[model samples]
Target: EAGVVQSPRYKIIEKKQPVAFWCNPISGHNTLYWYRQNLGQGPELLIRYENEEAVDDSQLPKDRFSAERLKGVDSTLKIQPAELGDSAVYLCASSKRTGGQEKLFFGSGTQLSVL
Candidate 1:
């Protein structure tokens, strides 16, 4: 089973520029999540997808961020007009179920460096 896969392990962009990251979840896993980790803070959930349904996205910053899970296997997260403050690791994770108690397996993440 492939662990989780993410692309462009790092990205650099000027403030107000757009950036995107991609993720592919583990095989057979039906629950996927996108998280944001600041400099030293723990990962915070931005969105969660169960199959193709976005079960939760209350934490996502609507001002400049958007996400989607197409076909329920792969996902993309986009930041339009990225901000300097958006520089952080955009992590993708997956679990066996939608239950929050389930353990999550994370990808290395796309570390966005906004200038």
Candidate 2:
């Protein structure tokens, strides 16, 4: 019944610091996604999870970024040694269906500022 939930709506940190974001997808949802949106740009998928398995994560920067969806429910995204370029809105979304035609419900997003 609830929509996607994300914590720490905003975060500010210096470059090289580590940051983490949390997400709780809607109940019964089978698909979850993490996306990054730079200013004036559309959200770009960072990772996508079908239940507990990460089905797509090629866009995620592995060196300093990591994510996990445990128990096919909640998920977390972390960025270590973050750079200024990492400043952006991190969005979490979920869908009940795996088909491409299904609509995704998005959370408010975490706004990160790396100085």
Candidate 3:
């Protein structure tokens, strides 16, 4: 089975600029998740997708950040007019996901730096 895949590996952008990241999760995975990792803090749940439905996304900031899972296989996350504090690792992860458990595997992530 393939692991999660994320693009660009790194990104550098100016404050107030828009940026996006992509992800392709493992084959046959039933659940997918997006997490935001700041410099020294734990990864926070940005979104969780079960098939085509966004099962959990309460923590995602609506004004500037948005995400979608179009086919239930791949997803994208976007931040518009990003802030300096938005510079962080956007990690994509996946799991088989059963019985309310999501033992996940993560990708290398897109490391965005806002300047």
Candidate 3: tens digits of C-alpha lDDT, residues 1-115: 6689999799999999999999999998879899999988889989899987898989999999999988989999999989999989999998887456558999999999999
Candidate 1 residue-wise lDDT at 37: 95
**lDDT of all predictions:** 0.93, 0.96, 0.91
Candidate number of the best lDDT: 2
Native-to-model Cα distance after best TM-score fit, residue 90 in candidate 3, in Å: 0.7
Which scores greater on lDDT, model 2 or model 3?
Answer: 2
lDDT assessment of candidate 1: 0.93
Residue-level lDDT tens digits of model 1 in 1-115: 6899999899999998889999999998999999999999999999999999999999998888899997999999999999888999999999989775898999999999999
Model 2: per-residue lDDT, tens digit, 29-56? Answer: 9999999999999999999999999999
The residue ranges of model 1 lying beyond 4 angstroms of the native Cα positions read: none
- Order of the predicted models by TM-score, top scorer first: 2, 1, 3
- Model 2 scores a C-alpha lDDT of 0.96
Task: Write down the TM-score of every candidate.
Answer: 0.97, 0.97, 0.94
